[model samples]
Target: MNKDIYFEDVNIGDSIPTLVKEPVTKLQFVKYAGASGDFNPLHTDDDIGKMAGIGGVIAHGMLIMGFVGQAVTNWIPKKNLKKLNVRFAGMTKPGDTISVTGKVVDKNAENNIITCEVFAKDQNEQVKIQGSFEAKLPKKN
Candidate 1:
């Protein structure tokens, strides 16, 4: 669960707690597709994915991004988030266990803004997404 974090309590280079998610599954993809309205066969149909030369059905990039978001929020509250950006690095396939990790990269005491660099990688250490986020944290009195 995310707890309130103060700007003074964090420092540049400090590591955020890691979030390891269970292996990806087709069922989860289906649910995500329904919720996201993506309905892209490449993410839900093995045959179409294979035909597209991606081997087989792969998890949606946004789903993996959501995992990264979860990791960030696990460290700080969503209300504090100011900016988030990500680049899709690799495909996430079924049975791939993803682990999201991050570290504080910069901090501005005047603005109470903290910047963090984060990445989501599979069990093999294959990077699925890379990103950074900025959050305005409260300063302890």
Candidate 2:
């Protein structure tokens, strides 16, 4: 899908298209917990979440990070990417819509790599994840 992107075709400040994800829910948290082997009650039990200071169960921060990763990979093929990192900044509730976006931050031609900065936001425009990505672009003939 990213066959169109070549090393010489991208530049700093170029905006990658946005990727939208479905809302988070309790079931999703439970499933993710089981899938990831992370059974932290704070992410699946409302009572424990409230007692921990957060009013309700919060989605796993890694899940939001995954969404951001999905955005970058969606724009550029997987093997093209070499590095990606995300920081969970805000809590996501059941009804929140997550949108992931990124921009070309720098190009490292000597190493055949391009760097990108990414973030995930909710419907309120509040940033939920702050992240960065680095990728290897195909060389031009």
Candidate 3:
């Protein structure tokens, strides 16, 4: 995919390929609950979710973050990863189409790190996470 984006192939203004994920649902919330060992009622019980002042069973923030992380790793590959950081900003409801996007913000060939600004947006164009990532790409010849 994308010829493995070598250090010599990208620039600060280059747009990273955007990845759109399927709409989030209760079933996915359940699966993520089991996989992460975080069966919080707020994520599974519609009643509990409402009582907590949130809409029915909001999606887990971690799960959404993971989706964004997947988009970056899938694009650049694991060998290039150096660091990733994100801040949760909004909640996602069922049936929302989550989109993950990123852009190459800076690149350092001497240290082999490519910095990118990453974000996950919902159907309403609301940001879920404001994040940044750094990956060490294959060195230029």
Best by TM-score: 1
Give residue 93's error in model 3 in angstroms: 0.7
lDDT of 1 at 52: 93
User: Which ranges of candidate 1 are over 4 A from the true structure?
Assistant: none
Q: Tens digit of lDDT per residue, candidate 2, span 23-141?
A: 87899999989988888898999999899988989988888887887788788999888988888899998789999988998998798899989989999999999989999888878
- In model 3, the number of clashes is 0
> What's model 1's lDDT at 53?
93
lDDT of each: 0.95, 0.88, 0.89
Off by over 4 Å in 2: none
lDDT per residue as tens, model 1, 23-93: 99999999999999999989999999999998899999999999998988888999999999999999999
Better of 1 and 2 by TM-score: 1
Residue pairs clashing in model 2 are none
Total clashes for model 2: 0
Alpha carbon RMSD to native, model 1: 0.8
TM per candidate comes to 0.97, 0.94, 0.95
Write model 3 residue lDDT over 1-141, tens digit each, in one string.
Answer: 535678888789787788899999999999999999998889999999889888689899999999987898788887778899999999988998999999999988688788999999998899998899998888657
